[model samples]
Target: MFAPRVALASLSGESDADWAKACEHPAGAAFLGGVALDEPTREAARAMVDRDRDEFLPEDPVEFVDDQLSALDDAFLRAGVNVRTVDLDPLREVTEVCASHDAVLEVNAHCRQDEMCAAGAGESLLRDTARLCEQVETASDAGAAISVKVRAELPDVHLPTLAQAVERAGADAIHVDAMDSRRVVRDVSDATDLFVVANNGVRTREDVFEYLSYGADAVSVGRPSRDPEKVRAVYAAVKEWFL
Candidate 1:
């Protein structure tokens, strides 16, 4: 899991510069991006892919991904912070790159974009729990520390059941974007031994503490991460709590 308890959540357009900046912060870990693994996956993310999107990695997806991951590994090596990459792709493709780079492989099931859903990749996977579990198992079998990121409020998606499925599939962690429902985090935590990461709207020490108190092993910051001060505040809050 992470130390300090605060993680920089996967932002759409996070750049190398963004990674560098986050490296200097006190957050326990930095999730690089929800990048696309192939042309199809990239196409599925088209609507959200802007110049700022992490999907803008390289012209050749695999090479570019490998290179970027290596760069992150180098950059964060001395910082003692974990580098995790989130991506939308088949399990095989994702596990290959993550294994090569020695980075954590997080499956992206939290995105609700229409394009992604149409591709049967993002939130669409929620309705297909079997597929999601398969992805986690595939990644885990490939020697990667697997993280399954899911949205808590998806229709008909039972948070605890999904968490148990992910755990049974060998996922090392469950990243929950628990929108307004701390109960989702609590339920998932109670259902499995997987490291629980609570995400969304976490801006202050109080927010971090609230999630942790609800059984999250770590808390993540998303939109608020655009501001370095907020990231710092979150880091300080986590640090203070640990002290």
Candidate 2:
């Protein structure tokens, strides 16, 4: 949970320590990376790059995570890493680094890329809630605070049901990327006690207020995160609302 309740969401290839730093002025937490953690996911990321997309494809994924987090050693705000992997082993490896750094390990189930879904990660996890819950439990067992980043409005995927299962699996938070269905935040929040961080289209104070009104514990800035004025606006909205 963050102070002013504004988090900087992970942007495909650009989210790193420097990106986080640039957006951290008024954010309580920064969820960096949607980093590819295993060979399968890395392969998918590479394929995405082939199509002119961006992704974090480090040679040594876990080590890269450790280094990125270490760069935030003196940061005043909380740090979190959103990770992608089809294998549990790599996820466990990254979770250890997150735990050591006292950072939240966010399991990425929000990405809608065809490449990611084919790799059995990203939005594919939404279709397999059981696998997603297992990831949350795996991260928690590694001594990391767990947050599952999920997308809304996926076909045949009941978010409220998924949220309850994730909570039971030991996730401390659920980051909801509510794609045009902001009310989904309320559904997830009402379904489970997991801290809900609502995301998508967050820019102004009104945007922040709308998500909070729908039961989000926090709201995150995605595309507009690099804009100081937009991030500051959400920060001010949080401060004012909580006052």
Candidate 3:
């Protein structure tokens, strides 16, 4: 989906400036959102959007989402950046918005937050493989190049099995938050034809190379992207290694 082999993973507080910084880098792709699709997911997005406060009280959920998407579109979409929006909602609700904006739709199954999991929207999906596959198929059917972002190490969840299921369900790519287990990326890559994007704990060029060596088609930088200089360093390292 991206020309470079490096990507900026979805992070909190992804403002227009954040997207611009990512575009300034040579990273292959930049993923925005991790936005809530429903009440369950909304709680988490509320926390991020209303940080420093203990509670989130929105008068209208629909308007809240519309406003959020509008602000994001205004800030980042026009930049011509290859951006994808990660969402916690079902495919049917989020697909059209993505298509309307020409943004790639990424289904998030990697979040470990209690609220999201309780709502059956995040890591909880890992255990519900059937439903996860259904979501991917729905997005793909809607003509979006779908990507499923999954977390590794979920109890009773097999990375390869999930990866293959998503691939068979028509997902274009699988973004794995390997979480200390690079083997998950390797196994997922080996098990599916879908493009594999490896995430977690990537700090240096060597970290990027290590994931690629482990069979990741792309490596994602998360926390590091908060610092433009660090992102630039990674971009420089990737260029040196790949070019």
Measured against the true structure, the TM-scores of the candidates, in listed sequence, are: 0.87, 0.98, 0.80
Task: Report the lDDT tens digits of candidate 1 across residue range 1-243.
Answer: 656677777766564435645544566666666666655566765655552334553566556556666666654421111222224244566577777766677888777777767777778888888888877887788776778888887769998998899899998888899987877898899889999989988986788888888898888777776777887888787777767
Q: Model 3, stretches more than 4 Å misplaced? A: 13-23, 43-90
- Candidate 3, residue 12: how far the Cα is off, in Å: 3.1
Q: What is the C-alpha lDDT of each candidate?
A: 0.71, 0.90, 0.67
Candidate 2: residue 168 Cα off by (Å): 0.4
Q: Estimate the TM-score for candidate 1.
A: 0.87
Q: What does candidate 2's lDDT look like per residue over 209-236, in tens digits?
A: 8999989999998988878788888899
Q: Candidate 3, residue 15: CA error in Å?
A: 5.5
Candidate 1 global Cα RMSD: 3.5
Candidate 1: residue pairs that collide: 13-52
Indicate the TM-score of model 2: 0.98
User: What's the CA error at residue 17 for candidate 1, in Å?
Assistant: 6.2
